[model samples]
Target: MEEKQMDLVSLLLRPELPNVQKELPTARYRVKRLSELLDTDVVFTLKGLPYGKVQKLRESMSDDVSVQILLQGCVEPNLKDPVLKEHYGGATPAETVKAMLLPGEIEDLSRAVERLCGYRKLTIEEVKNA
Candidate 1:
């Protein structure tokens, strides 16, 4: 009986692509798993991270400030990164407002989060930054 149930669960969990309406001729971004979005085998988890850091990210996600907060929380030696260190040195939330222009592959960060949010299905949302 357990084996039968396991088989049924596996079938139900398979990934399926949804019918997405493309706004333009160009393809639209689709939510993929975090592992897939990074194009590497690494699996990032938020386990054991500080709640304050995560909350700060959620609050400021609409802005680029969340990126550094995220990196500081999960990615080790985050402040050591020269690029981040130079731009964000003594960085405050207000300072981040003007830093990291052309955040190369900003899409990746957004998409990855979207994908993580939609682990069971591909759910995508686009927000224009003014």
Candidate 2:
């Protein structure tokens, strides 16, 4: 009798298979206007927010969602830093973000963070399952 080939489903179900998960991704964005204001490059490092946090932000529907996202996702120019907060004359991280960034800049950074978190509009073909 010949042995049968194991299918993908069977292979995946094998208990011995090591669980391999990739780390969350990060990206850097340069705010040109800010850089110009500072007379140097003002680049910010941002990481993807976890699904739970993103879901909570969505459900809250707060006006400061963008600021909240920046506070959570920005790894560089640390928005939560005490010095930055002082410089911005903001008492909280969210206030610092609002004071430091223009409305359009906040929106742009929020969109960038969302992209890193795997949010994007599906193409028509993709929506059709092509």
Candidate 3:
């Protein structure tokens, strides 16, 4: 995984020391609930295809793609019902995942590391000169 993504995963797994216990449970619960919500069934319509053919088409897609299409299909239904909209947050499951990872949710740990290292390196060079 990319460094940024890894950092995000680390942050999700374990936030800063003081908040770790509280944040961990909330994060785990949110991830589990979102996953279950995303796993619900979706019907697909294949052009000019009979039932069996459509089933085959659905089977051909990767799990990720299938879930994406399923969530997209739910948009209209969700829009029509307030409860569904509230549950879905006015966005698809994929979108919900993206929202959770936005800057608001996790610290910029990678950048923080880089800045600390840079400062340390500079201080070392200054000490050597002195």
Candidate 4:
């Protein structure tokens, strides 16, 4: 039994395991509607939200949760860029996202952010098995 426990600990300590301190996972999403509007392809790179930030966002219960997520998680095109913000009438990143995307689009992007942040439902049985 002691040997088995040591083996388990050794397996957990393997160097190949991911280091949470490293870069967060990222994904690219193409905004088809935006592309049509701009007459060119527009791809947005998004990074996963940290668990602590997601928890805070959920706890806040703000009306613009989706906008907040996009503001923080959207990496490509730099929503906070001064030039882009100026082009969008000097709007903040949140305002720019609201002006650029419809409500449905905002929700869709928020869902993607949630997935990246590991927000899927899991069964207790699965946890126990793992």
Candidate 5:
């Protein structure tokens, strides 16, 4: 018997491809798990991170500010959301990578992960300033 080796994109799009549509959160979890198994960091732009920090700005300056700074700094440089009329975004590094993976675009998964990690580093810089 022979074993088969599958690419990440194929694995993710196995059940569906042309009509592939997954819930954002579910996709995030899948990406996170894959990254962990592969010993890689999954990054996301800050816009993807949910908002609600202004209220906590005074009570938890460090945490709230850190989140804000991270969000502002890590947003995707060119990607935009047609529905939102804004750049595509996610709440965490994982979400960012997940968002990039449309059903048919799984082939770009590795590159997307790399870009996200790079963005994460930039976001860290923003945290320092905040």
Candidate 6:
């Protein structure tokens, strides 16, 4: 019989305050990629000799992309819809994201990017510094 050594401890998992002194300066802005949004099921015409059809199709398509939008704390309810109609012209949010959407106001770019990326937001101070 082999004896097993166990090292067990209990901990109260809680959020910790960041130590500003040890952390990076406030000028740094966290960046994220554009693909973090909706998941897509891309269909590609792969070239293979299975049943030996003609050459595979050269196009790729994906119509099954799932999206979950959380407008709260993001969009200003009072903001006129005409603003959206101006640039996007009723295009789907996914399309707007693919197009690297920017807000009408320069000051709102961070909020716009945050909504678009759905993960992080930039700061105006950091933007100006950069």
Spell out the clash pairs found in candidate 5: 43-93, 44-93, 48-89, 48-90, 48-91, 49-90, 49-91
Q: Residues 1-130, candidate 2, lDDT per residue (tens digit)?
A: 1233457667788987744224567899999899999999999999888888899998886688888887788889888899989998998988888898999999899888888887864423533535
**Any residue pairs clashing in model 2, and if so which?**
none
lDDT of the candidates, in the order given = 0.42, 0.83, 0.36, 0.80, 0.38, 0.28
On lDDT, the stronger of 2 and 6 is 2
For residue 26, model 3's alpha carbon misses the true position, in angstroms, by 32
Could you estimate the TM-score for every candidate? 0.29, 0.77, 0.18, 0.80, 0.19, 0.21
Query: Which structure among the candidates has the greatest lDDT?
Result: 2
Q: Which is better, 2 or 3, measured by TM-score?
A: 2
- Model 3: how large is the Cα RMSD against the reference? 18.9
Query: Which regions in candidate 3 have their CA more than 4 angstroms from the true location?
Result: 1-57, 76-130
Q: Which ten residues in a row have the lowest lDDT in candidate 2?
A: 121-130
Per-candidate alpha-carbon RMSD to the true structure = 14.1, 5.3, 18.9, 3.0, 20.0, 19.0
Model 2 spans with C-alpha error above 4 angstroms: 1-22, 121-130
Model 4 spans with C-alpha error above 4 angstroms: 1-6, 121-130
Q: Which candidate leads the pack in TM-score?
A: 4
Where in model 6 is the C-alpha error above 4 Å? Answer: 1-9, 12-82, 101-130
User: Candidate 4: which pairs clash?
Assistant: none
Instruction: Count clashes in each candidate, considering only residues at least 3 apart in sequence or on different chains.
Output: 0, 0, 0, 0, 7, 0
State the lDDT at 57 in candidate 3. 40
TM-score-based ranking: 4, 2, 1, 6, 5, 3
TM-score for candidate 2, residues paired by index: 0.77
> How would you encode candidate 5's per-residue C-alpha lDDT over 1-130 as one tens digit per residue?
1233456555767755433122111113134654676798654432222133323442565432433333333444323344332333665543443464553333233333333333233544333534
